[model samples]
Target: MLAVNYTTLRENMKTYMDKITDDYETVIVTRKDNKNVVMLSEEAYNNIMENIHVLGNKSNYDWLMESKAQLENGMASAHELSEAETDE
Candidate 1:
């Protein structure tokens, strides 16, 4: 992790961002007025958000596959679709 003041960020934004993404796992830019105000590495931030989505899904691929297998075996619950047959 790298800790840089916001002023330093304003002065060399691109170089700092590039260095963090290419070589460091994290970078923080602190503000003088706010002790902890900062900027985080865009790549690492994005990766963290993506994992949240994946982990938050309660019933994912394995559950879907089990449901499919049950349906194929005629063991899943059902309601007659007589309306669709009547429409035909």
Candidate 2:
């Protein structure tokens, strides 16, 4: 994540665009009136939206919470990823 003033971002829009797209970074543009905004890669935005969709559902949220509880209580198994599997 990178923070930049609105004026600075306005002056170097292309540079910031390249950073956000090529580097997959999130940019925080600060406003004078404190209305800050974020600029993220399209893939990042899509992933966030998908997560919101999943967590917004009652059943999905309940299942996720249950899974988290199980993991925290030592009821879940952790596995090490092999090199081939890690590539994905």
Candidate 3:
């Protein structure tokens, strides 16, 4: 990990470019106050995005977790919701 101020990044853009190699992961550019931008390689970006699926649906999450555990233990059972009647 490298912390570089925006001015330094702007001044040494070429040096920063040269520093990027296959071994390097990311280059973070920040202000003196530590506000920053993340620079990542395409392969790194793709790998990060690929693992983003771990962040799944927030709704019904607790239900899912409990049901998942139950299913794994062969104790899961389903209850069908009653259908609502519609009048014309």
Candidate 4:
């Protein structure tokens, strides 16, 4: 995470934007009156939204927890994928 004032961010917009996209960094742009904004890559934003959607659903969250518990308890099985499946 990086924090910079609005003037500094504007001065080096390309540098900061490149860093954010290349390194998957989150940047906070500070402003007056306690108004601030965050900058992140589109890929990062999508991943965050996807996680929120998955975890926000009660049934999906419960299913994931159950799967995790089964894996932790060694109740999971492993199977090799066939070549046809892998091709897809």
lDDT of 2 by residue, 1-66 (tens): 999999999999999999999999899999978999999989889999999999999999999999
Candidate 4 lDDT, 9-88, residue by residue in tens? 99999999999999999999999998999999999999999999999999999999999999999999989987655554
- 59: Cα error in model 4, Å: 1.0
Candidate 1 lDDT by residue in tens digits, 1-88: 7887888878998988788777854667776677765455677778888877765676765676788899999897867776554554
Give candidate 4 regions above 4 Å deviation. 85-88
Number of the top-ranking candidate, with lDDT as the measure: 4
Q: What C-alpha lDDT values do all the predictions have?
A: 0.74, 0.95, 0.73, 0.97
- Best candidate per TM-score, number? 4
Candidate 2 vs candidate 4: which has greater lDDT? 4
* TM-score for candidate 1: 0.50
Please give me the total number of clashing residue pairs in predicted model 3.
0
Model 1, CA-based lDDT: 0.74
Query: Looking at candidate 4, what is the lDDT of residue 13?
Result: 100
List the candidate 2 regions with Cα displacement exceeding 4 Å.
69-88
Q: To one decimal, what is the Cα RMSD in angstroms of model 4 from the true structure?
A: 2.8
Candidate 3 per-residue lDDT over residues 1-88, each given as its tens digit: 6767888889997777656556564789986666678877777777787656443555556667787898999996789999999998
What's the CA RMSD of model 2 in angstroms?
A: 5.7
lDDT of 3: 0.73
Per-model TM-score on C-alpha atoms: 0.50, 0.68, 0.49, 0.87
- Model 3 regions lying over 4 Å from their true place: 54-88
